[model samples]
Target: MRSIKPTHLRRRAFPRYLSTTTSAQPHIVPITSLLIANRGEIALRIHKTAERLGIKTTTLYTDPDASSQHASCSPHSVGLGAADGYLDGERIVKLAKQHGIQALHPGYGFLSENSAFAKRCEQEGVVFIGPPAQAMADMGDKARSKEIMTEAGVPCVPGYHGGEQGEAELLEHAKLIQFPVLLKSVRGGGGKGMRIVMEEGEFLQQLKSARAEARASFGEGGEVMLVEKYIVRPRHVEVQVFADKHGNCVALGERDCSVQRRHQKILEESPAPDLDNVTRLELWEKARTAALAVGYVGAGTVEFIFDKDTGDFYFMEMNTRLQVEHPVSEMVTGTDLVEWQFRVAAGERLPLTQKEIIERIQERGAAIEARIYAENPERGFLPDSGKLVHLRTPRVSEDIRIDAGFVEGDTVTEAYDGMIAKLIVRGQDRETAIRRMELALRDYEVVGLSTNIEFLKRLCRSPAFIAGDVETGFIEKWKEELFDPVVVNPEVFVQAALGVFTSHITKDAEPHGESLGFGTNSSERRFLFKSLDVLDPKGGEEVEVSITQKGNNLFDARILRKDEKAQVFENLVSSSAFAAGKTGLTTFFPHTRIETTVIEDPNNDNKLTVFQTGAKTELSLISPAWYERALGLKELRASVAAPMPCKILKNEVKEGDRVTKGAPLVVIESMKMETVIRSPQDGVIKKLAHKEGDKCKAGTILVVFEEEEGAATAR
Candidate 1:
């Protein structure tokens, strides 16, 4: 592949259609003008399809995302800062009216599942490019969707998808479903308002919490939880099915979304690995049936969870809009689902039959997609937000596709999803696809923020994944092996350490001097670093050394010794430092006391600070903007503060009321999760900043406390 800069790939501006063509062979109705109501990679993907179909596209973004790639995808773009516009239905409608936008496509999240939004679009004379409002309303609700599926002869996970949400009712239902039930919100997706109860003892507490979250997020309170059976050793797979206005529906294919975390899809692939022909065809038929049963139109996904052992699959949930991983299905199927969504919206019939769709998948190849997010894998996968300094992706081939909405120098904020881009690869087969993905990952690089790139690489090469023995618990099962770089392959560690060391040394070889020109000045030289470290076996701290020079493809560094000794490793650049060790790699980085593992490769004339006083200095570097403030504020406080941008649910205490530490103060909800604001200190409530439904943020004080007259301050 030729090395072409991203600028060279810039598409020519599209012109508005002068006229429409009519043919006898089910001529596809071309969408004239479209407005994308979401931001990020998915929006970018939809833009590409709209561009290819000669459809005029309009993209919207927030203030922080004004310069986002999605904004640049089309010629006509608008900046709708969340505070200024975007979510404001009236502003969006006004913009559409001004631009003469014929259709509105809610790409996946945000307003996609909002039935009222869809209805409003219909009322304002703009086509909603998704399932019908009635269909969305039915499927968007967990309980209603389950009832529909059950009536249609589709196997549903046993659950209580009915009545008002309550702790008493949900707990009773959970007891019937047995231990390890999933308490889900009836109104939302993306794992929000969802919680897993591992045992009966935690049912009531978790149920109450889940309901509070659902109420806060969806604006409808009560016990509207779906008490369902939690399937173990489950594989998350969904079928992409599309229907037209003429009552014809077809299933494109299936996508394996088994790789997940906290019940959210992270990695996805087409033609799920290890499935037999019978099972494969069965899934597709089931999807087709589900779509036809609901009289579904536009693009929709029928999700299901399969039991690897029994091969029993149960309906999970139906996403009423386009999915984030729809690109994978598109790559393998050789069809643009988004354009079809528009065609159907325009009252067109499906262009192809089920047989034709099946033949199409065979003509192309298998595809896999891995989502790259701005998160720290070592720190509980906490979201990392910061300005991206250097971003680069290798050449894109027929087999390689990248979907992104951010560029280098763009700041990732905490107010939105942490996704940066998607690394998608296609191959003649699964093995080839896996290998191509590995190469693509290595060639792809992003600097200035923490990400899960390394973690994904480890996952791509894992034995279970390679052998097609993956399930929903894949990440959890391989948590220790996937992360914890200290136990990395000796060869990989050696190579990475060498590469980083040599790059730095090569850059600073001239007069900046090795170690800031502090040559052999042991007294004046103090060094500190935060490389993935290894604990010392002989009561000494173990460390992974940062290499400074790449001599003949080998790392040249000094490995610290027990008696302050140094050793060298030469030519072995790919060796890993994380080998077998006593303790497992800890998830918390702050508490981890790992030392850098280094070895002397070249005889150094300059003094290097690999070890300091028989210990390694801690290096904690990450996007500080995304770090949770609550995790940082461990000091004394009379009352708890809001965790994020949210509204007050209900205050439990009144002014002048006495409360003990850890007692519930005010319930603040954000993104649907009801986080009970608790008192950090024992004192009498002096003031209440918020009432039953007040909007607040992380620093927004909920309540104030006064110390007892005779008691000293807790501090």
Candidate 2:
């Protein structure tokens, strides 16, 4: 990997299409070369669109990412050090100058929302392919943005957006609106810097915390505004709107981003399910009006919170840049938003009108997108770090599109966002699109790192999800039912065990030897069995696992005790020999061989090697399996543990506390969200794990209880 600077790889700006036969005015500038100031899928997405328009693309990469898919795609790519400040305006300006880059595209994150950065680009004689800094500044202010939305006839959520209001005033407003109001920062858009207070007593406390978080997340935490009406089952629906310098604005369509965790969307799809035609028209019309009112240009999203109970919606906020889930909108609209951004910046009129866009949506409709992230949902959805040992993505046809950042062996660090790829699938109808996406996800496998692929599969097939009854609380409500991994079908366990065993023998057996053991009339064969303890990350409870294997393709396992012990739940295993001969069977047992298929090399993010002969003790392979089995333990224990390491904010239990099963015992704070640890069984508190200020991790033993004399103890 040579060290190439952004200047050397800068794409030249293409002149506008010469004298279009149409009467539409010429674009502002012929966008020739564009420097994408971000990395990964977004950078690649921008590069592809820019290239298609005859525009050259400039991309920068950290040393480790020099060989990324996006980097290789660009005609010219520069390698920059991660510590060299890719997000810094000075560094970007320097690159632009060196590359002779005419414009800068701040993909989606990092410097995308930085008004000063955009202003710097303007001052440095570089075009920032986004909205004017002033527009971003105005909309960036929560109070001012709300004022604009309210003035424009968009139903803004009622609450305090006023500049200054005391805690008492906010409390009074809360009281008037009733409890369960949303305490939000004026500049808050994402789930961050926001809190949902269910009671009046928690108002001031939550307000302070929200303000502190806001100040940390966005400089100058503005007045803490209150939105009186908070929808419990709210759907996040946003309209993608694009405007040009000529004042021509159009709304592409709506995307249902209701599938979210901690206020951040995970899975997003276009053509919101069950959205009434009347509401759809109204939403598009309102989105167009909002964009026009703000003088917004380029690609932006007008977000709204839709309530299923009342069929009413309120404008949430306007994202003044490309959204993370724009692919879904693009698939349905048949419009390339990135290309439009270039043309709009080039001073071209919006290629389509609002009416025309509506007609087009009616014709070409239905698409869905799922964000594939290198995250572990079973572990409180924490970000994961590792290399892409073996990356295999499904091929994209007309209906499937995959936008990824890294390639095989690429490292996914915690320093950046968890997203690895965007899986977008399109169909004439929603069912076809979803089914196609499921197939793609199954085929798409990344072995080395932990991801939410399994979770996404479950979400897509969820009855509630299929019915479009999705809300922000969907994950919470159905998590228990959706995440019971303990009860895997007997056949899967048998296959997995055999795979493991076969892998072990292949590695240890002599090159010419027929069998290590388990041959004709063979018994008492000596084999090392490394027992793994699989514990839940959130709760430190461990499940008992029993694995027994005979020959290559035969195995059986049992759960000694489930966390939530029910009637003796049992499992059986079955397998068929693959080699089909005595010599082959003795040499390489099919089950053990397949069970131990090395999807990835645990250490090298780049290399994926399987166990062949010299069997060595490795923890990585078995540990994840252990954890996955722990994850399978669906039933909650009679005891409660901390979901994550967090300070015990408040305790609802005391020594000798008589509580029923499911009773809330303590409220633990982690990453700002307060999760209440509930009692799994009706029992008296025999012991307390921590005090109010004591911190504990997920699986931390928080409390214990003494069982009845005749009751069987957890074995």
Candidate 3:
């Protein structure tokens, strides 16, 4: 194979990043043109590496991602023209051949781990930048993978890997394994198609639900599940392994992804905190053994469930592609894994042997990656989608990396994953890393949709986490502190009052007032302040305030509250970063100047969000609570609504049906994950607005409860 370095490749520094490089090998056919068969941040991430390596690339985008940044990053492009186009491997492979692209890089997710897709790429003579098709097929099946790992002398979770999946037979297996067993689908990944059966009575019900979700997510093949002994306190540790065709494989290092939500990792760090060097080396050896067992090649991750109590670890699963949290490993190791993938795919030998791979490590440091998602962490991490509207990211430097697929104004549709970006920070040690992460989260901002930024900030400062005590149940264990109600400062109320006001103060300030200006001395502006996570304003945590603006927009602000001293803020110097751009609103108060962005709610003129630093406080103009209650404002709080745009998988309740609090009323599927919407209280269903198979947007009422007679009589 003759090597060819095309001229279309431009040598550009990867935006404050430079990947490790290697000399050209004579036995390699340099892939001058590549096609990225993925979308979102991963796609953009790949494109960056490809460009840095002087390789021309092509990217694919679906209809929803047509306007996405990743779609336009590549000089060459293709449109899938459908929402689920990323999963259409056949079409992707054909497009690669049609575009004369020499290699196709499946940057995780979608068809990245699909063995059939890898085989198709091989058949088309297009280099697939991943493990061999056989490796993927061998490790793709969770049960089979366990069997192979056991044969390879790798410790695996003790469980039933047999074909008898009937509830009765599974129950027998569970009995042997004891209570609190894990029911995992053979085809499960990313927390789908799995459930925890804590006791015998709930075994069958959990099994049924798991099977249903598995069937929906992975088709009929997902119906087959294996039972395993559940680890009460487990730390999710995974090793990054790379292999080449010449029978060489090496472990980059291990990462602790114990902090997760819904079994999906949210925070990941390298050199897993508090791990002993001896066990760490063993982990790497075991990971390599597992990789070599399947004749693996390219980038792969060997996940293990580390028993915190016993110090024993078992193989959990193998992800046969680059991972989302790969950046942390890169930051700590100072070796570009993506560049290695490209090199290995081009038939080059491993850049460094096992000894060199270990020796090449720079000075010791720690790196952590925080995943920012368009989800409300307070509300069970429900998915949220909308236009980015406003986005301000932390500065990207040598130690700080922001990998995102969307910019301001781009929309986060419900057709795909809700992850917005990844904030990766590196420091001299774990303590430094945690501190930097907290500060980074403080500088990051996002509006127009709820995000997990605030939740992550709390986790960064969490005592348990700071002390290096991490487990899969960390979030739930620190639930109260992590979800503590945010106290809105009284000064923020002044900011809110100055941030937005009406035109008429005394039945009129002047019929013609500056649209952006505040009200007068008697403005009597009434606004309620609440954190974005508070789903309903009726929550007792919310604060109601009345502000009377005497001067310009926040020029002179006086705040008064019950039992609180009246504070006056004068000389409210203000400036905007961009002319008429929603990006900036800097206001200087008496004590300090705060960066604030006030975004008027598109759906409601009376509602607005004031973004301070990175925290966002939502304020809405409303009548007094008593008056609104008397007039029946916004519907009663006796309804069940879809947390996100989703397809109703099953309606478990009907009109006139009575349900107890927490009883399942409906199951809705969003992006292939199913969530059961339960009754908020014990009441009879007054109406069934949506049934099975209906698609509804977020906040769409699915069921309304009949008003209670006692409450009604009081009204």
Candidate 4:
């Protein structure tokens, strides 16, 4: 890829459509070129709309994402070194000016809600395609937003949003609000900087952790914290509103974002299911009132925590920018919200009135969107970071939309959000939409790094979710079932073995020599037994697979257990009839067909990684002798290792420190979440491997503990 210098791209003359019109028509500021001030899927989303409007798009990327899919979509892109560069308002403004950008679109996250960044864009004479600076400042702070909502006649949760900033005062406020309160950073919006204190005994510790996280995430603004009464069994619902400079504002119904993990939304659907008409109308009315109260412009979301059983709702906070789940709203309303933001920023009146928007919502039906993240659900949903070797989404149709940030071969690094894509589908009703989403998730395949694809599928198919009985605590309530270990059927193991065996024979075959111990003579190639150890994400199992070659590219396979005699339980399979690609393989059996991707494990020549139906399994083709040797190897260890790549935030224990079982030895931060490493047993710390500020990879020992004398004997 050739690097294009910024100097070579100069400002060109504006087209007639973007030029100022002098007729009696409504005066509008023409924007011919836009600078996308964010990265990933949202940036690409904005560029698509900009291109449709005949606006040239320019994007800024971090060094790691310089060649990312979003970067490739834009005709002009500038490489910003790292996170700091992307958040540098002055640097971004300078680049926008140099590139002759007419407007700057902060595509959510990062500087999207930063009032200072918006002000900087305004100062640079570049249209900021969002709300005015004052609106952001008013609603950007959670505590302040609650006050504004209350003043605007919108119901707000009962809590302390006062100016007091002391820890004691906050604790006292929590006591007044009763136990089981929430300590949240006034400046925080995602799940970051938020903690739930369940009792008096845990208040102080929770407060300290929350404050530290707040300071790390929000900096100076994080110094102030707010205490709120925790709503039990609460449903997270937010209303999407759009406004224009012409004093017209319309609420585009509501979306239920209650399906969450760690307070971050994973699934969202528009026109909240099973909602009463009265409550729905009230939500929209209050949302409209709030938008008008702030003189809001462009797209924004007003979030509320609704008590499902009581039919009561309270204002939580307002996002003064486009949201991650805006696609659900777009799917149901048939509106391109990005285009709406651009037109509104250009001083155009809303294309539709409030009544018209509501009517459109009723006509368009239901839509649901499931966020596809590059994280492991079984491993405490720890975010995974690495290259995406192979990526595939469900077939795109009018009802199915795949908004992805990364592509095949792109890397999902630890420096950014783990969201790889969003699967959005529309249907005539909620049930239809739910079924469509489940099918799409099954079809989505991502190889190399772990993802929440399987978990999402289970969640979608869960009885509670399908029945629309969901809340913010849905995941917690069904944790056991959602994270249950996947049981790979014996058939799946046999299929994977055959896939690798066939691939190896085809690629490494000699004209007339023996292959896979199979003699060239047809009569002698009756049955070949291959003892294999198969490893899925959960665990590994050993089994003997026998195959009989019937003809060229044809074979019959079966699993042989040590205790039982080998028997063929399935019909023969012809490999030549199946579709096999470099990265993907399709196998056909008697009653079922399985599609999978096969990749040779680089570290082990005999091992192959197979991806089927969103699950990854590793197959190790080894002889019985090797399998016996592997089983005899001891795997016990005395060191506490990092579960994932992260920075060592703090070492709670030093060398020679005595610790009991489950004692936290160190704290590490990964993908914005902090995890503490705990001792596996009572022991003495023999060594400390890493220190604060050190970066460590998965399995890097952080602390080495020596078992107490006779500890193993005692166990």
Candidate 5:
């Protein structure tokens, strides 16, 4: 096996391809140029397929994403400022018309599912690279789509899809459906405006909460709510369907997206594991029927909720556009869905029949994709945004691939989703696919902000996940193993000490950029660092790492932790830090050495983020008389702080309101999700820093609690 090298990550520029072969059949109005009306990884995904097909492409980017690779890598691009925005279909269509673009591809978010936007594109003589407006309109509403599915002979979950959505009317239906009912908005997707009521007593509160969120997310279209029986112990499976101008529709394959957090998928794999041939055939038949009934002409996904124990399934909803996990299906089927979209919109026939697609899928192997997001899984999966100081991803090969829109030094703003990239791998079978995914995740590294990489690694290693036993509640079921308690490993301190020692030694040593400098230490070097972060910086357990110079780049290093054994390690090579790069180092521990990256926070030298085996560990370098350090450490136990940068939607409490533990204090909306800030304990509100509609950064105090009898409360 070849050792991988880390570098600044970026997608290479693609040239316009020219094919030599001629078409065998005639096609009308072939798309010569296209405008991608989206941003981030999805935009780049479309661009790559278009480039390979010899089609000209244009992309749009807002001010916040000026440096994004998706916008810069395009052959042609138009920059939209903060005011213009990606949601303005009129502006995008006008730009398309002005540039002589033949078609416009709305890549999955923003305006992809907007039926009105698709109609606008048609009226302006620009082909919309998606299904017809009628198809999107019918399936965009959950209630109406359920009725259509039932009429088309597709099995749907039992629900009340009537026009009457009054609070009293819905409450009566909840009783008819029994306890543990689901409240969903008429126009809902992406888990917004949806809530689960576990009992009859909690129906009304959950309804009101769901309604408020629905209205906020979908406007007037979300005013109506529907009631249905919530499926317990269910697995999420969706089938990929494609159609053309001809009267032929086929199911490409199926993917399992059961592993999720907060109702969004994090891991997905093709050829859903542990299912017999009979179930797969049934799954495909229903998915094809649902798409054909609505005249779906382009790419679409029909989602289903499958009973884990019975193999019975029911239609959940249908996505009118491409899904984020489409890559896995493509990997198994040997298809380029974006290219198919271009051909279908240009009045072409289906490339293959149903039997041909299924045969191809069977011949190919299994594939899995893991979504890499800029969020902290340990902190309730809160979205995080900041500049990526350092970023490295696994190299793409025959078995591994990476799709991304950001590179090193790019800023991840709160104006859009926090996805960094998608890591995909393929193998001969299910077990091989899982093993490949695990190794790929262990090779990915990131810095400057929190991410879910470590959590993803743990998920790939879980026994249940390995055995293909997974469902929607997999994370909650395996939380104990996924979120293991942080134990500062002794290897981390040794790696950090060597990195620090070599970083100063190599200030002018550029000859051995791949190895630590072979320079002699002028004097004894010592560093003061803390093993873990505490409320008081001065009153913390300090770790002492001492270095005594022996010769050129050779030294004796000792680590002394509070109330622990004193351990010592010496250099195996001339330099204590053996294999070293500008941002990485390998420290020898008597018998073995491991690669570690030492990154000093650009803003503060006292803050260090050490990467060991692709997992990040944070330690603070203690500087004496650090008045500034004390000021930055907030009283986390006495105040409720914002989890991330977001706008306050509402304040649920007054300045002097008394609240019990778990009481809602504030409601905030960020990254298209609503979260309620709750009281950590019983206390009275002493102050509120920001009011409703105010924008605040992460760690900004939203509510401060008064000390009651010397006991503190916070969130």
Candidate 6:
């Protein structure tokens, strides 16, 4: 309800460009307050830049994100309903007007590329901090953009970008382009509404799925589709370009986004690795031409699919808005792109020329960015959504930058993308940057949900990645190494046990400020033996540990193996409780010091949650009697369940229908990806719970099966 104001307004120390023949410079629009039409990290990112420019920012939030970090980043926050609130253009423009917002910045998603929304802002007399509406319409559609690129002398991939909408006609074009062609929505971006048909037999099914996703994502413009040649093992690269209303355009540089999973980029770096000087220049030139052809007026990205083996690159599409990976480009160029966007939207000319931009890139060296997502890489990279019980980022440094959206206790719901944060690092060279990123990832920690942190670490250390041999299929090629189960070392478990024990003792002894003698010696107190059941992907291990005080904040800890021989391992270690309100313990050994985050179960104090090296280990301190009872319980039944909250698009079976193993039973859509739930065995459908168009939650059983007689059932 109250308007937000910047804490302080400081003039930026940048050169002011003078107008030609300065007889009172021409009128430039003044933007005092702006509204960011997006949410999460991007909203916070835009707000910070606006604050630095002495511009107040107003941010809109869905009901779930009403208390999110982004909402609090700006005091002028509006709570819109959960569903379709950010995407509602008219309401957003009205809110902007009510708050006296001079400009609107659509941060890289939602209505970022929607031309209608831009036109609406223009109609409302509010400046849109992006490209012109005409340019967005011309470049937002994949088919039209390819046509424009070809006219501008930019090489384009051979495909069908026709105006036909019939399924048969599109199928004919696919055949002409040959098998393994790509089906894409004309207005799609970020891998939505895109599918690859490897054979003719699977064309129609993929087309339907692609169309469904496109319709859900793009709405009105989703009716049209385009087909392209699916380049095998090509490098995904894009050039960042900026244009001013004065017709001056410059291409910053290229970012290699080849490492991907599910067609979405996970890693991106500036000054694409292994690119020849000649090829890089050509890429920049083509990108500039593409932007000029569209009369681009703000920040845009020209994406190209590059064949590394042949050094051939073709324009894929141009994103008519700021990209999510713009931070890496900024680090490599020593320029704040968001600031440029603000200035350009106010009808200001570019501060630097093409030559100056190139010089900055050369001086800044190399930079890399890794997107940290709350997803399970081993489970087909399926997105995970839940509350972040604990979150800790590495300390920010000159060379290291962390752009995060969520803090501790923030919930990662299924309403948006799974990305938690982006970790970017810069160095004097490429190898140094890679090593810095690895160390940064190891220092990053998040619990209460699955993440790809460990997977990113292995990827950075991969030999092929180090050699710069990357392609769009890099993750798929190295899936085995990247998805291998992590082996939690015994020392980590010991450290966790020590951390938990120390915290418990310190809490109990806080009131007296002295030892509570339960044993014969008053100074030396003995704690009961605590059995920790360590659970992992590999079975489980039970270790009985006991501690006795020896000196000030020093204790003798002993570990006994419950299985096989009663082997005893004893060591004298010094441990101390961390500060109040902190969730960790500090342990000092003879040669090493260990710091770990230890979370105890609120209901059961004996259980501990340890976050170590980006992986979570649940250690349940149990009694010998409870351990026996826990092991005797039977495991739950395996049923076909929804991986995430999604609407059932198709139901291929009914109750009592007998199905064979691997038969597709249902199709569900979530987060723009279609997952086909198939039968695990030949069995009769005992229960068909949901119908098409009905929404279901993750772990909700869609179909339950009763095994057929004499049929081999494998789960």
For model 6, the stretches where C-alpha displacement exceeds 4 angstroms are: 1-26, 503-568, 578-583, 588-591, 601-608, 613-635, 656-666, 678-684, 707-715
At residue 60, give the lDDT of candidate 4. Answer: 88
Native-to-model Cα distance after best TM-score fit, residue 118 in candidate 5, in Å: 1.1
The number of residue pairs in model 1 that clash at the backbone is: 43
Q: Write the per-residue lDDT of candidate 2 for residues 62-133, one digit (tens) a residue.
A: 765666777788878777777335666788878998899999999987678777888889899898999988
TM-score of candidate 4 versus the correct structure, residues matched by position? 0.89
Whole-structure CA lDDT of model 4: 0.77
In model 3, how large is the Cα lDDT of residue 581? Answer: 24
Name the runs in model 2 displaced over 4 angstroms.
1-27, 61-86, 165-169, 220-228, 509-715
The residue-by-residue lDDT of candidate 6 on 486-514, one tens digit each, is 55555555666566556655675421112
Q: Which regions of candidate 5 fall more than 4 Å away from where they truly are?
A: 1-27, 504-522, 531-542, 572-582, 625-637, 707-715
lDDT of 4 by residue, 493-554 (tens): 65666665565556654211124555555421222222232213323555666655666646
Model 3 scores what on Cα lDDT? 0.80
Give candidate 3's TM-score. 0.89
Give the CA lDDT, 0 to 100, for residue 381 in model 1: 59
Across 1-715, the per-residue lDDT of candidate 5 in tens digits comes to 0111112223343211111122454366888798999999999999999988888999999998888888887878899889238988889999999999989999988889999999999999999999999999999888889889888888888778788878889989988988788888878877788898899888898888888888877777686888988888889999998877766688888999999987788999999998766677677778888988897888999999887765568998999999888889888888888888888888887777777776787788899999999998877888999888878788798778898988888988888878889988889898898898988887877877878888888898899999999999899999888877566677777667667667756665322111223345354566666754322334345677776667665667778887889987766342434232335765556777677777767766666778786567778766554423434443334888898999998899999999998899999988767889888788888898998899999878899888666445343
Candidate 5, run of 10 with poorest lDDT: 1-10
Q: Write the per-residue lDDT of candidate 3 for residues 1-715, one digit (tens) a residue.
A: 1111222234442121112233443368887999998889999999999999999999999999998998889887899998989888889998998889999999988888888999999999999999999899989998889888888888888789899977899999999999899998988888888898889999998999899988877776889999999999999999998887777778888999999988889999998999866677777878888998898889899999988877788898899999998998888778788999999998877776666556444475899999999998888998889888677899989999999999988999999889999999999889999999999998876777889988899898889999999999999999988988776666666555544543233223332212324433243444554434364334533445555444555455555554677666666765444322243557777788787666655565555567776676766544355336534553454677788899988889878998887899998988777888887677898888887899999878888888885322111
Local accuracy by lDDT, each model = 0.67, 0.67, 0.80, 0.77, 0.80, 0.78
Q: Which candidate model has the greater TM-score, 1 or 5?
A: 5
TM-score of each: 0.73, 0.73, 0.89, 0.89, 0.89, 0.87
Model 6, TM vs. native:
0.87
Which scores higher on TM-score, 3 or 6?
3
Which regions in candidate 1 have their CA more than 4 angstroms from the true location?
A: 1-29, 83-85, 215-217, 221-223, 487-528, 532-565, 569-715
The clash numbers for all candidates, in the given order, read 43, 35, 0, 0, 0, 0
